[model samples]
Target: MSRTSGATTSPGAALAALAGAQFTVMLATSIVNVALPQIRAGVGLSDSGTTWVVNAYGLAFGALLLAGGRAADLLGRRTVLLAGLALFGVSSVAAGLASSSGILITARAVQGLGAAAIAPAALALVMDLFPPGPGRGRALGVWGAVSGAGGAAGVLLGGVLTQALSWPWIFYAVATGAFLVLAAAAAFVTTTPVRESGRFDVLGTATVTLALTALVWGLTTARRSGWTDPQVLGAFAAAAGMTAAFVLIERRHPNPLLPPRLFAAGRVTAGNVLMALLGSVWIALFFFLPLHQQQVLGSSPLLTGLGQLPLAAANMLGSTLAPRISRRIGATATVTGALLTEAAGLLWLSQISAHGSYLADILGPSILIGLGLSTAFVQLTALSVEGVARQDSGLAGGLVNTTRQVGGAIGLAVLATLAGTVTAHAATHQPHLEALTAGYRAAFGISAAVLAATALLAAALTRRGSTPTAGEPVPAGPASTAARAN
Candidate 1:
């Protein structure tokens, strides 16, 4: 059998290349937030239309993730990574050059497709680079740090680029970074022998992708048309039907994109469940936070980006500290504590006022939310892949990411819709700024409730002591790799 031991190149170079690819994938998700106003003005998009610019990428990325993971196992990890980078680079440039809303949204979706491929393949490569030991643990820590930091850093970069140059420069910058990573990867990352052989589950992929698309569309459309609107109902119905079909297809497929057996582990299920909740809050936080800064506080894009620095620092610090904390406490306590901390922070954030200052209203909560969110993300990620068999590591990686992205997409849609509804109702008597603040407050409040509930569920559902202790490295391969894939 071909060696499944490690990367052929120097481990450091390979890890950097893999991590860089993952960072770019995450950066694309949040970098557009601070520039949304410019993008809307430049493309003449409606508020609802602008939401699609964000949703389209997330939808595609979440939908295609399982397929991408499977492809990496069957085709080749390095080949898939390279192809994803090229596509991502090209599409980002296309997005940057687009003159119309349709073109930009389409480019963003294509970028998502590339991201779908990049994320799984790069993560799998990290697994291939190191065995399940301290080397792998340290590598995964770096991955977690970058993953957590990427979102905050994106907003900062987006602000600088959008203010200094233009909104399009954000895409241009991503393209530049992607191409640079592609080059580095080509030079340093070696091809791994294809470990699994199976034909693509085309029907399963189609049904699941369509199901996710329909669900997101239903949620997003509900904001404009009332929840009971026939169109919204139809979208939801279609989503349900497609989801049922996908589940049935998975049951029979000789090579299912997502194996039903993977859900048997309580830890995996609880980890993913909480991940969805966390993702919903994570994605919406970025979306609403910047808008609140710009719209309510009257901060400039650059100022909004700079304001994210504290949150970014806190996130990095949390990620750095999570494994150590997990070592001192168990993963269960660590994760639960993190969730409660996040919920408290979100609750604090829900009190945002039209006249509030950044220092008083945003800064403390940003730090709290950032630290809690990052810590929870790292621990849950480790929990998610705690017991999977070696052969299924790649699929587990994809599944965890899929849950996070899909949850974010759906969560953002839900929160945005709720906020919009609240704002509309409040607008009858309140000033526009106050109305907007009311909406944001409602979203944050709901997010806090969801997180608190998630914490309770996570505590109840996770098997106590099943997770690795802090001293014991979170397994990345035979029951481990999916942890860092987050």
Candidate 2:
């Protein structure tokens, strides 16, 4: 075995490279939000039709995340990373130059597929390169910070590029970043052996991907078609059937995409649940916050991005303090406290009016929620991966990410539904501004409830400070206990 670790590199150089790649991936996902309006106008898209541009990418990326992670474990991480980057660059260029909305949407979906491959591979590489300890914790913190920062910076970058040049510039920018990361990855990453020898779970991948796609499509279509519509009902039914099939398939498969044993522990179950709920809330905020700033607050794109800076800054601060806090209070308590703080912030934010001031109404809540989410996310990631064997680390990492993406997709669909329903109901009784405010308030309220529930779950499920002792074989689950005793 190679004794060289990432720590041998210049202090923090490896972390910087990892964070740079993570930032670029996250930036690609978010920067498109600011350009949506321009793209809608340029391509003559209906309001409903335009949303597919974002959803297409999100769905593909979220659905394929597990398979991508498995690929990283089986193939070389470096190879997967490079392939993903190349695919992202090619798709971005296609999206930038497309003349029609259909072509652009297709290209965006391809870009999402690339993201699914790249994100897990990148995360797994980071974990493998940095040995598990305080060094790993710090690197994870930087990763979380970069993820948060990319989200914040997206609004600013998108606004500048869209206003100064065109919406296409967003894709161009992502392509440039992808190309740069590809070059850096090729130069910096050393080759590692494929650790897992099991056959790929092709059937499991297909069923789960289709199941999730059906679920998201059903939820999204429910907004326009009313849940009673045949299309919506059919999609839901298909999702249920496919999910059942996935369960059965996984039980018999020698190498399942998601091992059934991973969920045997209470901590793993709770972590995955909390991740889903918080993930949804986080994505919903990103989707709606910008809309609220531009549409309700009458802020320009650049001004809106700047106004949201408090949240990003607070998130970084929260992440930086989390490891220390965890050491003192334990992961469960720390995460619960953070979640409660976030819940309070979300509740306060739900009361915003069309005439609300940014500083008085938004900033305080934004900061609190940012702090809460940042702290909770780090702890959640730690809990999910703890006690897993070295070889299965990549799988654990992928599952954590998949849970988050799936949760975000669900949250976006549910919030969008609530917003649409509120707006329609209010429009029937009141003015346009009042209707929009009603929609925003309803969405925020629902998100607050979700966060509160997640907090409660985390408190009930996670135990205090359960870090594994050095060199002790990380137990897989209940079945592994018998094997260990032998």
lDDT (Cα atoms) of all candidates against the true structure:
0.85, 0.78
| Clashing residue pairs found in predicted model 1 | 327-470, 475-480, 476-480, 476-481
Least accurate stretch of 10 residues (summed lDDT) in model 1? 477-486
lDDT tens digits, residues 51-112, model 1? 99899999999999888877776667778888999999999999999999999999999999
- Which sections of candidate 1 miss by over 4 Å? 1-6, 264-266, 469-486
lDDT of 2 by residue, 1-486 (tens): 221111124435555666777788778767877777788888877766666777778788889988887787677566777888899999999999988899998998899889887887777777766555666677677777888777777777887788788999989998998888888776677664444437789999999999999999999889988989999999999999999999999999998988766665326667777898888987778778778877788777677768768888998998888777876677778888988889899899999988887987799999998889888888787667665444455566678888888888888888988899999999998888778888988988988888888888777778534443211223456433422332
Q: Lowest-lDDT window of 10 residues in candidate 2? A: 1-10
TM, every model: 0.95, 0.93
Candidate 2 Cα outliers beyond 4 Å, as residue runs = 1-11, 264-266, 464-486
Clashing pairs in 2: none
